[model samples]
Structure formats: C-alpha cells, structure tokens
Target chain A: MSDDELARKQRRRRNIAIGLGVAGFVLIVYLVTILRMQANLAAGP
Target chain B: MRHKPGMRQPVAISSMSAPDVAGPQDYFDLLKPRVMSLVVFTAAVGMVAAVADGARVPFGLALASLFAIAVGAGASGALNMWWDADIDSVMARTVGRPVPRGVVPRAEAAAFGGFLSALSVALLALSSNYVAAALLAFTIFFYLVIYSMWLKRSTPQNIVIGGAAGALPPVVAWAAVTGTAPVEAWILFAIIFLWTPPHFWALALYRDGDYARAGVPMMPNVAGRAATKRQIFAYSVVLAVAGLAPYFVGMAGPFYLAVAAALGGVFVYLAFKTLRSGDEDKASAKQLFAFSIIHLFAIFAAVLIEDLVALHV
Candidate 1:
C-alpha cells in the first residue's frame, strides 16, 4: 500500500476508536444515571 | 542537559526515524497503562475493603467510579508525559514513550490530558459521591502540577512527597464506596505512601545512570548511594510497621496480619541486603526493585482476599 493509503487507514481506525469510546461513555452515563435514580428512589422522599 | 522548569529544551531523538504511523495505540500509550493497572488494582481493593467495612454502594456505581478513577489516573499520566517529554527523551527507561518518540505531540498530549482530567472528575461525580470526585481531581492536580511540573526536577525528596498522588487512588475508591475516608482507608493510603520510597529508590539505585543522564534528581543522585540506601532501609522499616496497621485497625483479620508481617519481613530484609551490598553492586538493588512490586501486590491481594471472605462469609 502507498504511504497515503496507510495514513488514511490509520485515520479511519482512529476515528472508529473515538466513536466507540464516545459510545461507551454515553452508555456508562446512562447506566449511572439509572442506578443513581434507583438508589434515590429506593431511599424514598 | 538538565531540564530546567519553564525552559524549552529539544527532545532527544532516537537514531530511528519517528514512525509515520500515529495510531490509536500510540494515543493509548499516552495513558501509561501499566501504571493505570496498578491504580485500578489498588483502587478496587479499596472499594472492596470499604464494602467489607459496611459501606453500601451499588455494584454498577462502584464499577463506574472505578472506571472514572482509572481515567483520572491516565489523564495525570498523560500530563506527566507531556511535561516531562524533554527529560523523558533523555532517559533510557522513558526514551520510547509516545511524546518523546514523536508519535504524539506534546501539545496534543497536554490537551488530551486536560480533557480527560475534566471528564473523569465530572463522570466520577455523576457516578459516585462528590468526595470521591474531589479526591480524584486533587490526585490529578497533585501528580501533574505539583509532582511532574515542579518537584520532579527540583529535589531528591520528589518521590517521597509526590508519592501522595499515587497513594490516593485507594482512598478515593474508599470514599466512592463509603462517602467518607476513615482511618481504615487512610491505613491503606499510609501503606502505599511508605511503600513508594523504598520501591522507587531501589529502582533509582540500579538505574542511577539513566536518571543522572536525564538530569533528574532521584534520591541516589542527589544524596549519595549510601545515604539513599539508608533512607530506603529506614522507610522499609516504617513500611513494615505500617503494613500491620490494617490488622490493628480491624480492617483485616489474622490472615492479613500474618501475610503482611511475612511480606514486610522479607521487604525489610531485601532493603537491608540492598543496603549492605557493595556500592558498585546493582544486583541487590535490582532484586529489591523487583521484589518490592511483588511485596506490595501480595500484601494488597491478601487484604483484598480477606475482605472478600469477610464480606461474603
């Protein structure tokens, strides 16, 4: 493969990694929010 | 070629050309994953210890907080790499790190670190208690601003004082679980803080040339080898004593006490061996350096096992 081709491939991989990382972060936030809400709700007003 | 703080120095380049491919792995390397692993282990032990002590935290929350803590640690590692890039290039042990090797730019490292620092702290607050988040923030700041940027280049006592940052993860983990870091958590903290000096000074003893060439003032470099040996032995003695505090404080049972005493004895003996070895001998230093890692790991593992047993049974 050409140098430019290798560079483009690397960039694509990096973007994919970033996308996955962001998705993972969002999932964690959602889970945490649900968990915290459950705990607070279980505690009552 | 001493790296003066606030002075710009050129990075020491390897004879090999910088890799044109800057991949995700290079960015991951910026996190100092090995160090992050230790942080994760110690912090997990802290969380388990808190649970054993009657702290009621959800498993999911605990897991999330641990992730944030790991990210916070990685952020600090990235910032340290950013600030120490110049000296890192000089040191044989660190010459291949991402920034120094030119796979990652220094500014990018700084930005990455800063972003992760904020993200980790904010995520921790959302996932855990404010106390844990605050401690995480302080750990990052202490490692980056206080240790990496300032004390690392300035004094021989750098590791001794800077050890606090490395030791805080467990305390932060305890706070995440309990929302309070009581004496039990502090006992864990104390064990790691004391363990730091001897562990690092042992490495410094053997790697004196790397540190000297890099112009970093490690204990062996700033103080003579004999003095550094003495200090290591002294800290080892104290560390041995501190290692027993968990049992006394009721954090662990007799099993932990037995394991801690046995490990601490060997640690002190190794430190003593390193002390008694000829000035030119690197063998003992190398042994002590390698054993110190196992020593700390075994002690914490013992505590973690005992805590798990207590929590379950």
Candidate 2:
C-alpha cells in the first residue's frame, strides 16, 4: 500500500476505537441502571 | 589538502512519537473506586441503621440518598485527581491515573467532577431531606476545598482534620432518614473520624517514598517516621474508645459492642506493633491498612445485623 493509504488506515482505526469506547461506556451505564432497578423490585414489599 | 565535514540532524526528533496516551478508563481509575466502595457501603449502613431505629425512611428514598452520596464521593475523587494530577504523575501509586496518564484531560475531569457534584447534591435534596443534601454538599466541599486543596499540601496534620469528609457519610445517611442530625448519628461520625487517621497513616507509612517523591506533605513525609508511628498509636487508642460509644448511647447492641471491642483490640495491637517494630519491615503497616478496611466494614455490618436480630427477637 502507498504511504498515504497507510496513514488513512491508521486514522480510521483510531476513530473506530474511540467510537467503540464511547458505545461501551453508555452500554455499561444502561446495564447497571437496569440491574439496580431489578434488584429493587426483587426486594420490594 | 584535508577537508572537514559535519553532520546535520533534524532539530525535532519526529520519529520518536509520544507514548500512546491513556484513555477514559485511566481517568476512571483515578477516582479511587476501592475507597469509593467503602464510602458507599458505610453510607448505606448508616441509612439502614437509621431505618432500623424506626425513622420510617422509605427504601426508595434511602437508595436514592445512597446513590447521591456515592456520586458525591466520586466527584470528590475526580476533583482531587484533577488538582493533584501533577503530583500524582510523580508518585508510583498514582502515576497510572487517568488524568496523570493523559487518558483524560484535566479540564474534562474538572468539568465532569463539577457536574457530578451539582447533580448529586440537587438530586439528594429532591429525593431525600434538605439536611442530607446540605451535608452532602458540605462533605464534597470538605473533601475538595478543605482536604484536597488546602490541608493536603499545607500541613502534616492534614488528614487528621480532613478525615471529617469521610466521617460524615453515616451522619448524612442518618439525616436522610430522620431529617435532623441526632446525637447517635454524631457518635457514628466520631467512630469513623477517629478511625481515619490511623487507617490512612498506616498506608502512608508503607508508601512514604511515594508521598516524598510527589512532594505531598503526608504525616510520614512531613514529620519523621517515629512521630507518624506515635500518632498512629494515639489515634488508634482514641478510635477504640469512640467505637464503644454507640453501645453506651443505645444506638447499637451487644453484638455490635462485642465486634467493635474485638476489632478495636486487634487494631490497637497492630498500631502498637507498627510503632515498636524497628526492622523497617512495613508488614505491620500493611496489615493495619488492610485490616482497617475490614474493621470498619465489620463494625457497620454488626450494627445492621444486631438491629435485625433485635427486631425479630
């Protein structure tokens, strides 16, 4: 591959990593909230 | 005829790229999750204790208040990391933190911390009582302003006075249920207050070089090791006395008293060994630090268990 293509691929990989990280964090928060609510329901009167 | 030649190089070494910068997880690590867990657990115990005492706190409100306290504690951790990132980078124990590691920018950390602080306090006020909310705000202020900004760098007596931030969680939990600070709540506060110095100083004793390298004025760093050891012994004695106060005040029962007494004895023995050990072996400090966590957890756990037993029997 040309040097220009290599640079572009690297940039793409970086962006993909950043996107995945942001998505994962949001998913974790959503899951935690859901689990907490479930536990609260289980312990309810 | 002889000719002389010189070599020329690029002014900037562009090939040597900066080490891969840390990402979001690094910043999260700086918030001291282990410490935050203990704070959250103790705060929950405080809330449970209040409920067990017939304060009539709803479970939902109790949970919300606990969440708010946890967020506030996280905010304190983030803010401390933001401010101390410079020193943190120099300390072995703290060098891997997000802010220091460049995973998260300092400005972002500060903004995130401030946002959490405001959100937590506002939510607590809405979900719980204003007294609880106010105490939460004060706790954040104490940790950030009093402890982190001023006391940490200014004096060897820093943690001694600043331990109040950690000590207030139970009181905040109590106020959430009762809508007022009671004498019993303050007694619980005193137990944690006296417990903080000795527990933290033990860690400081073991990590004295880290504080010295970072230029932070920890007790062992500012005062000599001997003085720090002596203070640890003194604080342990005070903590043991304070731990028994809950029973006398009728807030806890025989179970809690027995657990507190046994744990306090061990704590004092460890502190005494830490003081007398001349081998420079930090085993006592390490043992005391680790057990101190268990000690606090057990004391609060005993409180909850005893209350449950009383209600049933």
Model 2 misplaced regions, further than 4 Å: A1-45, B1-27, B279-281
Which 10-residue window in model 2 chain B sums to the lowest lDDT? B1-10
Show the colliding residue pairs in model 2.
B22-B103, B26-B98, B27-B98
- How do the residues A1-45 of candidate 2 rate in per-residue lDDT, one tens digit apiece? 765665566556656766884585455445445545665687896
Candidate 2 yields a Cα-based lDDT of 0.79
Clashes of each: 0, 3
The residue-by-residue lDDT of candidate 2 on B78-105, one tens digit each, is 9888887777777778776767666567
Best by DockQ: 1
Candidate 2's displacement at residue B110, Å, is 0.3
- What TM-score against the true fold does each predicted structure earn? 0.97, 0.82
Superposed Cα deviation of residue B119, candidate 2 (Å): 0.4
